[model samples]
Target: MFKYLKNDIPASIVVFFVALPLCLGIALASDAPPLSGLIAGIIGGIVVGFFSGSRLGVSGPAAGLAAIVAAAIGTLGSFELFLSAVVLAGAIQIFFGVIRMGIIGYFFPNSVIKGMLSGIGIIIILKQIPHFFGYDSEPEGADSFIEKSGETTLSALAHITDNITLGSMIIGIVGIVIILFWDNILSKKHAFFKILQGSLVAVVVGTILQVVFSSNEALKIESLHLVQVPAPEKLSNFIDYLSFPDFSQIFSKDVVLIAFTLALVASLETLLSVEATDKLDPEKNVTPTNRELFAQGFGNIASGLIGGLPITQVIVRSSANIQSNAKSKLSAIIHGFLLLISVLTIPMLLNHIPKSVLAAILILVGYKLAKPSLFKKMFSLGWTQFVPFIVTILVIVFKDLLWGISIGLVIGIIVILVKSYQNSMFMKISEIDAGKTTKLVLAEEVTFLNKATIQKELFNLHENSSLELDIRKTRYLDYDVVEIIEDFLIQARNKNIHVHLLSERGNVDNPESFIEFLKLDKIKTNETN
Candidate 1:
């Protein structure tokens, strides 16, 4: 781990800056206290990092879990009660790990997985749109069909004018520009800025600007778009904010259901993130899924015990870690340590930082995830891959993330079933004597679904034509399909066409005997001629 210290340390600092705002944002989105997200992040990095088998997977307060947390809180009627569910979820995940259910992740098709990632990328960008434009009424990290503000997500886009914050917009643009410049220009020009990281620089600049603006009353900036942390004067006061779960609600069936939902959603999200992060690792390291689940379970339990938000392996922070050159578990470890130190020592410093700056960083993260090239590549891959990919993208963009993924999965399964059906049965014709004596061979194991196509081919035969259907290779024939074959044999006799049925276990000359011998219905194959 220390071998890459020169590169990894700098990367961890960058990731730390990137993670700081996300921790807060995800917590805010979940309707949990802002510090709860930070706490989760700190524990994610320290506890999960120490125990995780992943070389690059980063754990945090994931946006994907925001909906679960919010619904759980609303149902449980208290954030503390919801935390109990989180602990239960962690315990369940640990059980999943112990049972070695890691292989479940592979059951998802590659097409579906790609669609899922792309769909999620689109959702992240869409959900972050209001935040990027200085509108926060809809809640942070919301990617649901029905938003918390009682509007479909797109309708909220139209309502952005009503809740626009000028300070946030202005600072957001400035922050975005600073990040773009730093990433594209300044870092190339100066070593110090390169060392500091574009995100950190943008945060610093945003903080300085906030301070400068706050000093002047004429600027007229509200504190709503700024980070807020409870200032504690002493250790005891700080500890006062710590709360535990109200297990009194545990007896409620609703609470138990909510716990199950959290466990499933959190586990699935973490598994997907682990898959994605491993692909992004520079070293191409593979994370042990079961072990990662166990680590995440412990992290979530710790987070819940401390009034922190539910945690998962988050791709945004993981990607940031990769871009920041993080190596080994050390980067994650140091970043967690920094989280503890920063919240404990300089929360006021965090307050000075504008929300727009963080939004800018997230916008960058969003863009990275849903880059234009990804869309183009999907299109170029052809209809089978492209259709589901595009559908997933559009659905995610217009609908919700989960809905879009479900749609893509449905479409992908349809494609698979169609392909399988097409391959399940076939017909072979040998043209001889100018198609007069065509030999038609039926595929192995004919089913009812293949009847129509075969019937169509049979009807195309001319009067007095000869047709042979070889079913010796067929192990199982559906009753409906056998009936269709029997009906066709009668039609062939009437049309002056000769029909032949070849089966290893049946009488080939007597059609009815062939059917009876094959254990099919007592259908007549033909007059035993």
Candidate 2:
């Protein structure tokens, strides 16, 4: 990890800037003190980063959990109680890791995963727009389409003209230009530009702009439109900001329920981020998901102990780290240290930085995640992939992350069911002088899901048909499908249909009964095995 210090150090600086506001914003959205987010960022970076197997994934207070955290805090009656829940949640996540439940991430389809990344990217862009223009109506880290202020994302945009601040707009536009130029032109031309990432440059320039315009009334940006790091007057006063959990509430039923919910949701978010980060990794190194859970659990436990919001392996910071040219987990660790030092030593300097500059950095990050090329590529993969991918994006954009993903999973499962039903059996019908001959070919694996389709096909057969059932390709036949076939065979007699059963063991004419035939088939299959 130390081997890439030259790259890691600079990359860490970029991630630090990217993570700073996010930490505060998430805390604000969660209705927790801003300092709590910083603590989580610190722990997530230093603690989780050290334990995580992932070389690039960055952990911090997640916007995805903002609503849950807010609701939990309110429901629990106190922040201290909520902190207890967070600690328990971390313990539960560690249990999940111990039991190897990290494999849950692998269960999500590739299309859905891609959709998640793209959807998050779109959300980041939308959420950042108001900040970029100095419209600070909604909290910085709120991810839902519907804001607590009662403004929808589209409506927010529509009102942008009325709320735009001259200083913020100017700084934001210049910041964006600097980043774009650095990424597209300056970085290509010079090594210095590569080492000093565009995001940092944009931030520096925006800070300088803020100072230069501070004296001008109309052009000045407000304190609310800048980074808001809590600045304690003295070093000793910092301890006052640290919160401790109420251990007495550990046994409370509501606390336990909240803990379980946090554990389940945080674990899921971590796994998905692990997958996304690995995909984004230049070296394509696979992270150990179970280890990631362990790291996250530890981070959250540490975070909760100090009155912080729950931590997860966040995609926003991870992607920012990757795009900033992070080399290893060292970058993530270093960023945490930076967060610690910034809050302790130079918070006022941080406060000088414009929110619009950070918004510009995130806009670029968002663009990378939701590139138009990705949409076209998904479409080219056919509807099987495209439908879920698009639905996930749309739902996430219009709703929230979890709901979008849940709906996408439903759509993906439905698509699978449809395909399974269609492929369960292959039927070919031919007209013969006697009547009609129907040949039914069973798939390699027949499940209960195929029963309805098979029954419908059977019902559609001609009254005087001669039916040939082929089971040579079938490996495992479900009991429900077998029952369907049995019921069809019984009905065949009344329809004057003659049935011929074909298997690897050759043909049988008019099997005595479906149950007996299935038993014989099973015996043959076992013998062959």
Candidate 3:
């Protein structure tokens, strides 16, 4: 773990900076105490990080679950009751992991996965627009297009002109410039620059600018526009911030329903985030999905026991970790440690950080995830891949992550069925002396989905024609397809069409039961009829 300290430490610092505002924002979005987000972040980073097989994924209170959390808190009558649900949710997630249900992540198409990341990137950038321009009406990590502030993603931009703060905007602009310069020029020139990290530098500069503008009322950023780290005032007083779940309510029906919902959402978000993070990792390391589910389960349980919001592997922070060049799980753990230490020790200083600065940093992160090149690359892969990829991004930007992914999955399935229908078999025609011959070659691993297409071809074969049916390359031909061929053979003899069956064993002249024939081992044949 210490082997890549140089890389991991620097990356962890960058992730720490990225996660700071996110923790507070997501909590606010969920209508929970800001400290709850911090607590979840701590557990996600430390507990989940330690147990997770993913080297780069960062977990925390995700914006994706903010709506459910907000509603759950309201429905459950008290935050304590909600905490009970969170604990139950964690137990449910653990059961899911033990059952190896993490395989659900594998069923998602590659196009849909790429679309998910790109869609998230677009959402991040869109949501951050108000923050970047110094409008703090919306939370930092909101996942939906329509925000709690009563504005859609694009509609909110209209209010920016009236609500934008000059001081925050100035710092945000400078931060973006600094990050761009540091990433493209300075870091490439010196090892020192790499150690400091562009985002960290931007955060420092933004804080300094906040202080510089303290004396100027015309340009001063309001407290609402800055990072709102909770200040406990004393070491002993910090204990009051921690609260345990009211386990008495854990068995209630409302609590049970909320717990199930939280478990399913959190588990899915974690699986998808880990998958996306593995893709973003420069080294292309694979994360164990089942292990990730287990890690998140424990993390959520710990968070709930200590009064934190529900947790998941947050892609925004995870992507930031990957972009920061994190080398191992150590980076995630270090970031968690830093969040705990900073929230407890130097929160006042952290509070001085302008939300706009973090917005600038996230804009960079979003750009990286949804670069124009990614669109072009997906497009070149053809409509089968690109259609689902593009659709996922659009839906995510307009609706939410879950809806967008669900839509993309449906589209991907349709594309698969279409492709299967088109390529189920190969057919050709030959004629000599007024006698016509048809050649039908079945595809490898033909399934029931191909039955209709194969049936259509056989139905079109003319009477008094010679037919050559080839299965030499076929493997695992579906029973449905075999029945179609068997029916066609019976029709051919009555239709007076001579047939030559081809397989590994040899040629057969319209041979008997296809069911019994298929019971034989797959054989190769070259003999002619």
Candidate 4:
């Protein structure tokens, strides 16, 4: 872990800056104490990061769960009650890991995974646009298309123009310019430029601009547009921010239901981020998904015990860390320390940093994730892959993260079913002296999905036609398919169609029963599926 300290430290700083507004915003959105978000952020980075197998993933209070958290809190009648559910959720996640359910991440199609990354990227860029111009009505880290503010994601742009702050826009533009310049030019010039990342420099410039513009009424950024950390000057005062879970109701029916829901969603979000972050890593190391689940379980348990929102491996911070060129998990661990230290010692100074500077940094991260080249490449993969890929992006942009991915998964499944129906068998037809001659060869794997097509071809056979059924190449067969063939054999007798069954065991001029013949041949049957 110490092998890449140089790279890790610099990346940690950038991630810390990126995580600050997110922690505050998600907490506010969840209707909890602003500090709860930070607590989760700290635990996620320190505890989760310490145990996680992922080299680049950074965990925190995710925006994807804000609405659910808020609803859970409201339904449970108190924040303390919600904390109990969070604790229970952590236990459920641990159980999931014990059962090796983390393999769920591997089953997702590649197209859907890419779409998830690009969709999140597009969301980051669009959502930050309002903040870039200093319209901060919506809390930071709120990613849903429909916001608590009663405005849609795209509609929020309309208000930005009228509420735009010149100071914020100016600083935001400069921040973007500085980062781009430092990354593309100065960083290449010397190691000095590389150590002091462009994002840190932009934040410093943004803070100084806030102080410099204080004298001008039109230019000075208001407190609303700056970081809103709840600063505590003393250690004792900071302890007041912690909230403990009410464990009496931990086993209540409603609480257990909410816990299950949270566990399912949080695990899904974490696995998705793990997949996405690994892809973003230049080294392409595969994170152990089961270990990640176990790490997150402890992180949430710790957070809930001391008054914090639920946690998950977040793609945004992880992406920022990866883009900042973090070489190891040390970047994530140190960022947690930075959050703790900053909150304790310099929160007042941090509050002076304009949100616009952070917005600019995120915009760059978003652009990298949703680059136009990715679109062209996905399109080149053809419609079978592109349809679900594009659908995932649209739904994510219009709906939310889980909805988009789920719908994309459904689309992928449908495509597979259609392909199965069309390619279930190969047929050859010609006229013989006795009548029409039809030869049907089964596909490599026959499933219930292929039942309909097989039935249709058999039904279309002409009277007095001679039929040849070949399934020698089919390695796996479904019970539904066997039933369909059995029915066809019955129909053939009435239609006076001659039937021949060909298999590895040899040919039968007319097999009496499909099952008995297959049983004799010892063919594999996947009836359970």
Candidate 5:
């Protein structure tokens, strides 16, 4: 850990700046106290950092769970009651880790996973656009396709003229231009650009612009968003922000149900982020998923105890950490410390940093995750992969992130089932001496689902042909498939082809019904008999 700290310390500062607005934004979206998100980010980074086996994984309050958290607060009648559920969720995640359920992430199809990443990337970009123009009606980086302001993400963009702030827009455009210039040109110069991070430079510029514009007061640039860190005059005054759970609601069945839902969703989000962040890492080091869950459990417990939102390994923050060149868990720890220090000491300075700068940074992060090259790569994998992938993206863009993923997963499962049904049964026919002799082999197991494939294989037999169907090893044959086989026999007769059945247990007691059969002898049977 100490060895990793050399590079990680500076990286943490980058992650800290990136995480600050997100923490407040998500907390505001969830309708929880603005400080709760910060508390979660701090605990997730500092506490989980110590226990997590991941080098690049950064944990925090996730946007994926914001709707759930918001709804939970309403259902539970208080934010404190929701905290109780968060605590329960942590315990549940710990149970999952103990049971080694982390392997569940492996079962997710690659196409769906890629689709999820792309969807989230698109969402991040869309959500930040409004913030870039200094529209503060909605929280920054909210991913739901249906905007909180009652319109689609794209529509909100079209209506941006109504809510635009000239100052923030200017700062945002300048920040984007600087980042692009530094990344695309100056960084290659191998001079001062290497010493000065592009994003850091853009943020500084944005901050300076904000101060200058605010001082002038003549431009009337209203709606500029900033990080609002609650200040306490004394240590005792800080206690007002602390929230306690209402244990009286613990026994309610509704509370238990919501608690379990939170656990499940939070666990899935954490697992997904764990996988995604590992892929984003430049080192390509894999994090132990079970260990990650255990760490998340502890982090969530602490977060809830301190009146914070439920914690997960958030992909947005983790990606920022990776892009920032975070080297180890130390980066996560340091960022958490930065959160504590910034909120406690320099909140006024934080309040001065314009939202557009953060939006520009997130826009860059979004581009990296949803590059056009990714779409081409997915298409090259074929329709079996592309169908679900595209569907997931559309669903996410049109509906919600969770809904899109669920749709993709269902489609993926259906594709697998179709392939399995076709492959489970097979028939092969070969013609010798120009179709005089042929061989037909029944598959190991022929079920009703395989009737179409089997029928197609049998109908292709040649006229005046001698064929052999070997089914001696087959243990089970459904009646629907048997009927198809019998129908094929009739068709073969009309075509002047000989069909031979390979079976020892062909009692065929019910001549009209193909399913009827009994084993009179213990010996195996085949077409040779």
Candidate 6:
């Protein structure tokens, strides 16, 4: 891994810039101390990165889990109790890994996965809009439609005009321009531009602009609009920020329930991110799913012990790492060290950075995830794929992440059932000298659901016509469908219709009894066996 330091170091710097604000934002959204988010980021990067099978996945405090963390903390009645739950969650994840349960991730449909990424992208964009214009009333990482501030996403945007700050707006605009220039123009002109990430440049320029406007009352940005780092006067005071889990709460029923809930959600999110990051990896490296669970389990355990929020493999930072051309896990590890060093030594400098600048950086990430081309691509795949994809995006934008995914999965399953019902059998009708000859072909697997359609076709058959019942392609025929065919053959004789049965055993002309024929065929098959 150290062999790629030239690539890893630069990528780590970019990821560090990308992760810093996210750590604080997620912590704030969880209603935990901002330091807890930072702690989780450090452990996720350093501890989890050391053990993870993924070459490029970055782990941290996930925005997707913020609402759960907030609610659990409230219900548990103390942050320490919540920390205990997080530790138990980690243990549960380890159990999942040991039992080789990582295969569950593969069961999610592709449409749902794509929908998830796009939904998260749109959510990031919508949530960042207010921050871009200097409105910071809502927490930075809240992704729900109904915010803690009692304002809907659209209503928050509507109130942006009233809360706009001139300094923040100016810096925000400049930051975006700098980022656009760096990405579209400068990066294309020189390889050096790639090393100097657009996000880092935007943050620096925004910081300088903040200093420039500090003296002018009309143009000054408020403290609320800047990054808030807990500045300790001494090293001892810094240690005081860390909180440990209360082990006494381990047996509490509520705590145990929350722990299982966290384990399930965190495992799912981690697995999905693992799949996504593998797709984005330039080298197409396949991460070991069970090993990833082990990494996350221990990472969360360590984080909770240190009074940090629960940890998971986050797609946003992982995508950022891939886009930044990260070559190995070294980049992730280095970024964690950077987070630790900066928070311990240079938090005041970090505090000088404006939230609008970070918002500008995330807006670019959001646009990349929810590009217009992706929507058109999904639509072209047909309704079966597009319906679930679009619904996932809309629900994630209007509701929350987990709910949106669940709803999309249900829709996708429904689409599959509908298609199965329609394609259960293939029928063809041709005119003959005697009458119309109808050929009915059963699918590979015929179920009871096809009984109604088969019954309708049989009843509509012309009298004195020839009917061919083809079961050559069928492997498993349901009892209900078989009975339907048997009943149809009986009725066909009364109507003067000629019935022919086609099977692997060849043609049978006017069998005495369909059921007797099936019984004879089964006996012959058993003898062959």
- TM-scores for candidates 1 onward, in order: 0.77, 0.81, 0.82, 0.79, 0.75, 0.84
Clashing pairs in 2: none
Off by over 4 Å in 3: 1-34, 53-89, 136-153, 243-288, 309-334, 432-434, 510-529
Report, for every candidate in turn, its global Cα lDDT versus the true structure: 0.74, 0.84, 0.81, 0.83, 0.75, 0.83
Name the lDDT of candidate 6: 0.83
Task: Give candidate 5 regions above 4 Å deviation.
Answer: 1-34, 62-85, 136-156, 186-197, 218-224, 243-266, 276-286, 314-331, 421-430, 434-448, 459-464, 468-529
Candidate 6's residue-wise lDDT over 1-529, tens digit each? Answer: 9999998898898889878877876675566777898999999999999999999999999876765687688778999999999999999999999999887777778898788777766766676677678875644334456665676666667667876888888888998899899989998999777656777888888999998899999778888888877889997798776788998979899899889878877898899999889999989999999999999999999999988899999987898888888899999999999999989998899788887887787677677878999999989999999999999888867765667778999999999888878988899989888488989888877678778888999988978998888878876677787678778878888888888888887778855765667545543454454
What are the per-model numbers of colliding residue pairs? 2, 0, 3, 0, 3, 0
Stretches off by above 4 angstroms in model 6 are 1-14, 25-33, 63-85, 136-151, 244-265, 279-283, 315-328, 510-529
Candidate 4 has a TM-score of 0.79
Write candidate 1's Cα lDDT for 1-529 as tens digits: 6788887677777778778878876665565777888999999999999999887777888866664576568768888888888888788888888998777666655565566555555555565566666675764324455656566666667778887766677777888898898889987887666556677777788778777777666443577777777668875688777768777777578777777666766777788888889899988988988898899889988988988888888886787788677778888878898998898898877777676777677667667766888878878887778888888767755654456667877888888766645655555656677657666666555667777777778878889777777776666566787777778778877898777666665437665565566554222322121
Better of 1 and 6 by lDDT: 6
Off-target runs (Cα >4 Å) in candidate 4 are: 1-37, 54-58, 61-85, 110-126, 136-156, 183-196, 243-262, 273-287, 307-309, 314-332, 366-406, 430-437, 463-465, 490-498, 510-515, 522-529
Report residue 217 deviation for candidate 1 (angstroms): 2.9
- Model 1 ranges off by over 4 Å: 1-11, 67-77, 109-159, 184-196, 250-261, 280-283, 319-327, 367-404, 426-430, 436-529
lDDT of 5 by residue, 106-202 (tens): 6768788778767766766776787788874643324444556566656657767886777888888998899899989997987456545677778
Model 4 Cα lDDT, one tens digit per residue, 209-277: 988988999898998788776776677897776789999999999899888878877998899889888
Q: What digit string (tens of lDDT, one per residue) describes model 2 on residues 1-529? A: 8999998998898889778767865665566776788899999999999999999999999866765686688779899999999999999999999999998767777898788778867766776778788875544324455565675556657767876888999998998899899889998997667656677778788999999999999999998887776788999998886889999979799899889878877888898888889999999999999998999999889999988899999987898888888889999999999999988998888789887887777677678879999999999999999999999989877765667778889999999999998899899998889589999999998888898889999988878889988989988788777778778877888888889988876688855754577757854565567
* Worst 10-residue lDDT window, candidate 1: 520-529
